[model samples]
Target: MFCVDALDVAAELALPAYFFFASAASDFAIFLNMPYLYPGLPSFKDMGDTLVHSPGMRSVRAVDMPLSVQDKELDMTKTRMYQFKRIAEGRGVLVNSFDWLEPTALKALADGVCVPGRPTPRLKEIAHGLESSGHRFLWVVRSPPADPADVFQPRSEPDLDALLPEGFMERTRDRGMVLKMWAPQAEVLRHAATGAFVTHCGWNSTLEAVTAGVPMICYPMYAEQALNKVFMVEEMKIAVPLEGYEKRMVKAEEIEAKVRLAMETEEGRKLRETLATARKMASDAVGDGGSSEVAFAEFLRDLEKSSMENGGCNN
Candidate 1:
C-alpha cells in the first residue's frame, strides 16, 4: 500500500522504521533530547538580546520558530504526541544527504541513525550532449502555495515575458523558455541543455542538482535555504552564492555576473567536478546494491511482515 506520511505508515504497521532527517540539522537539534551535530553554526549573539539561545535554534522572539514548537499560548501537547508516536515506532531514520556535506552533523545523526543513500542518476549522455551544444539557460522556480496570492497569472499570459528584467527577453529570445510554474524538475535537470541552475536551495532542489551533476547559483530567500547555501557553497563546493543585494532583492547584473562565474571560472570547474562525484555517489546509493535502495527494501519487507502478523491484509 502507498503511504503518504512516513510517520503514519510506521505507526499503522507498528514496525521499526526511520526518517531521513532533512533540512537544517540545527532545527532538529533544538529539541531537548536531541544533540546538535554541527558545532560551527553561527551564534545568535548577532541577533540581539531578546532571542533565546538554544542548541539548534536561536530566536529573539518566540514567534520566530513554528508556532506549534515554540513555547506559546497554544497547547501543542496533542501535536507533539502525534509527532512522537511517529518517531517512536520508526526502526531508524535516513537523511537525504552525504557525510561530506555535513560530516559532524551527519555523524551525530548517525550515532543512533541510519543514513540511507541518496538516489541520483548519472546522465552522461545528457551531459555530453549539453556540452556540445552551446546554450545558456535560466531556471524559473516555484513552490506549492502556502498562502493565496491576490493576483493569479496563468503560465501562458501574453505579457509574461515583458515583466522580467529589461533585455532578458531579447537576450534569451533564441535560447530561453519561460515555464510559468512547476516544470518536470528532474527531467529538466537531466536534460542535455541545462547549463546552470538558479535555485532557492530547498533541500530537494539542492539534492536534485547534486544528483544531476549540475552547478548552482544560489539565491536563498527563506527558511533553511540560507543554511543549505552554507553547505552547498562552503562545504560541498558545488555552488556559488549570488551577492550584491541590499534587502535580498537580487538585481539582473548580480545574477548575470554570478551566472557567468558559475559557467566560466576555476571555482565553477571545481564545483562541476564535485557535482560529478556527488552524482556518482548518489547513483551508487540508489543502485541495486546501494545503501538507500537496500534499506528501502528492508523497510518494505518489515512493513509487509508486520502487517500480515497483525491480521492486516494488503488488497
Candidate 2:
C-alpha cells in the first residue's frame, strides 16, 4: 500500500496510511531546534568517536557523526523536510541491529531491532575447529590514516609483503592472511582457523567478535574504542590491549608478542571461555522468546494500532 503525509494527499486517497521515524522523532526535532548546539568542527578522526557521541549529541564535534550530519553548508530546513518526509510515509522503522548489542541507544530509538534469523552454525563449527586444531591467528589492522599527511595520500602506502619485520611474515606466512579495506568479519570470526582477532576495537567489530565467542587483541585508535578496550580487558576479561602503541607505530615484535599472548597464553584461554558465555547470553537475548524479540514484536503491534487510530503512525 502507498502512504503519504500532508492532509491534502491523505484526504485525496483512501488507503491505509502510516508513519515511521528512522531516528527518534522527538530527539531529531529537539536537535533540529538547536543546530547551533552541534560543534562547528568534526570531533575525532575516527568512526568510533562519532558513534560514541551519537547517543548524547550536544555541541558535539562534526567528525563524530556521519559526513552528511557534519556538512556546514547543507540547509537545515531541507534536511528536516526530508527527514519528516521519510517519517510520514512508512508503517514502522526498523533498525539494523539487535537489542543486546546497544541497549541504551536502542531504548532511546524506541524502534524495533530486527535481528537477522540465521543459525550461525558455521561460526560455531569454526570455533570448535579452531579449538581442536590449536592454530595461531593474526588480524591485520585496517583503518583510515590518522595523520593529516597520510589522509589525502594515495592508497599505495606500502605492500603487505613489505611492511613486516624481518623474517616475521615468512615465519607466520603459512598461518596469516593480509587484507586491506574491510574484512568479511563475521565469516572470518566463524572460520576454523581464527584463534584471535587483532582489532582496533571498533564497537561493531568488537560486538561481532564477542558474538562469535572470539577473543580480541585490542589496538584502539580513538573515541569509544579506547573506552571499549577498558571494558573488554578490565571488565569483561575477553580482550587484551596492545600497550606500546602510544607512538601509534606497531612494531613487529610487539605484534608478535600480543598475537601469541592472545592465542596461546593462559589468560587468553580464560578470555575465550568468558567470551563463550557472553556469546550465548547475547544469542539468548535475541532469540525467539527473548526480551529483544518480545520488545520488537510489541513495537510493531503498537505501530499497527497507532496507524489504525490516527490514520497514520506516530514516531
Candidate 3:
C-alpha cells in the first residue's frame, strides 16, 4: 500500500520513483521469488515448522515464517505479500549492499537463490556461549517484545542477575560485558576491538557487519531472517550458524561452539580475512568511481530523461 502510494504520488507529480531495499541482494532475490514460493509452499499450518525447498532459493521453514505469511488464518495476499509483489512495479530496486560481499548467495540469486533476510531467544544460552567459547563478548540485550499496554511506560533497567542463570554473569563478568540495548550499535561495529557479532539477522545489522568487517554467529528468530541465515551460513560462507537455534532454547554447548567458530578457531580466522576483503570492497563501492556512485548517477539521468518525456517536471 505504501509503495503504491509513493508510485501514485510520483506519477501525479510527473516524477520517476525508485524502490530501495535496505538489505542484502540475496534477500532481495527471495522477495522477488516470494510470489512463486508462497503458492508452491506446502500448507505451513498443517506441517508447522517443516522446510519447503524452492527453486532458485533456499529451503523455507514453517516456524520462522512471519505471522503475516505463515498464519493461514490471515488473508496473506492482502498484506505483506501484496506489498512485496508491488515492488516489481517500481522503476528499479536499489539494494543497500554490494555484489562481492555475498558472492555465492548472489550467484544463487542469479542462477536460481532469491534468498534474503529474525527474532531472538533468551539470555542464559548467550551468556553461556560467551563463557564456554572462551571469547570476549559484548552483548547488547534488548527487552523482549513490549506488551502493548505497557508500551508507553518508561522501561526500568533489566536485572541481569535475575535474568541470567545463577552465577552465569559472575563467571563471565570479566570475559563478557552485557550492556543495555540502546548502546551505540554503529560505533561498536566500527570499533577495532570488536571481533565478531552475534546478531538477529536484521538487514541493517547485516550491512553494519559488512561495513565493520566482522564475522557473525547467525541465530535467526523469525520472519524471512531464516532465508538470510541460510544464505550467509550455507551459501555466502561468511558467517557461522547457531545449531538448534530455532528451537527457542539454544543449549550452552551449541552456543559456545558457534561463538568459537565465529571468534577463536581457524574457521573464525578465515572468516575474518574474508570480512576484511568485504570491508574494502564495501568501502570502494561508496566513494568516487564506485559502482553505487555510478549507478546512482545513471538512475538520476534516467529520471531526468523521464521528466523531459513527461513535459519536464524538473525542467
Candidate 4:
C-alpha cells in the first residue's frame, strides 16, 4: 500500500495506483487474510516450534509462515497486516507467477502440487539411495556455492573434493558427472538424460523442475522456501522431503534415502507422471496464449495506462 501522504498526492494529481506482490499467491493470501486469522491463532505463540496448519492454505504449517504474519505483537507485523488489507484498494494486482502453479489460490483467491502414497517405494531414492537399493542413475554433482549461507555451508571454502565424501568421485565416475562449474540448467532439464532433481524448492528451481517434468527431493532452507516445500510436498504432492531435516541441513543417510526415493521406487514412477502433467501445464502457461503471457500483457496495460493518466509522474 502507498503511504497516506502519497495517496493524497495521487488523488490530487488524479493518478491511478496499483500494488505488485513478489511472493507466491499463497503468501499474499495469507498476508491479506492475517487480520481475520490473527485473533483465532492467538495460541500460536504457545505452540512453540510445533507444526500448525495455516488458515489460508491446506497442509501449510505455522512454521512455514513469514514472521510478518506470526508476530502479532511486533510493530512490523501490525504494519504488514495493515498494508496487506489495503491490497484490494489498488487499481489491480499483478503477481509475478503463473496460474498453473497456484491455481486454487489464484482462482478461489488460494495454491496446491505431488508425490505418492505410502504403499510404493518412491523414486527408489537418489543416485546413492538407488545404489543402496540396487538401482542405477546418471547424477550431476554441482559445486557448492561460494557463499552458501544455509545448511551444508562448507567450512573455510573447501574444494569440491573436500566437500564430498572421500572416493565418491572415483566411485561414481563412470555412472555420474561431477560438474564443479556451472551447468546449463535449462539445457540439462530439457535433456532426456535428466530425470529427478533434488532441489532446495526455490520458486525458480521449482518452476524449472515443473517445466522439465522432473520430480524433486525437497530440501528447503531460509525464508518462504519452507512454504514452497510444504506446497510441493503436501498440497501439490509432486515432491518428497527428507524426514527430520526439512528445516535443517541433512546428513549422509537422509540424503541417500531421498536419492533412492527419486531413482527407484513406485512412488517415484507416480511422481514422474504428475511432473509430466505439471510440465505441460507450466509450458502452456508460458506459451503465446498462456497464463503468464496474458498476465504480463495485463500488467503492461495497467502500467501503460497509469503512465498515460499520470503523465509519467516523476518521483
| Best prediction by TM-score | 3
Arrange candidates by lDDT, descending: 3, 4, 1, 2
Q: What tens-digit string does per-residue lDDT give for candidate 2 at 14-66?
A: 43444433332223322322233334433224333343333322233323233
TM-score of each: 0.62, 0.53, 0.84, 0.72
Evaluate model 4: give its TM-score: 0.72
True lDDT of residue 77, candidate 1: 31
lDDT of 4 by residue, 21-69 (tens): 6656766665556555666676444555666544435645666665445
Residue 84 displacement (Å), model 3: 1.9
State residue 224's C-alpha deviation in candidate 1, in Å.
2.7
Q: What is the lDDT of candidate 2?
A: 0.52
Deviating ranges (above 4 Å) for candidate 4: 1-20, 39-56, 67-89, 110-157, 180-182, 247-251, 307-315
Candidate 3 Cα errors over 4 Å, as ranges: 45-67, 103-119, 147-156
For model 3, the local distance difference test gives 0.72
Q: lDDT for every model?
A: 0.54, 0.52, 0.72, 0.64
Between candidates 1 and 2, name the one with more favorable TM-score: 1
Candidate 3, residues 140-214, lDDT tens digits: the string is 776655563343456667777777889877787787788875778889989999988888787788778888998
**For model 1, the run of ten residues with the poorest summed lDDT:** 114-123
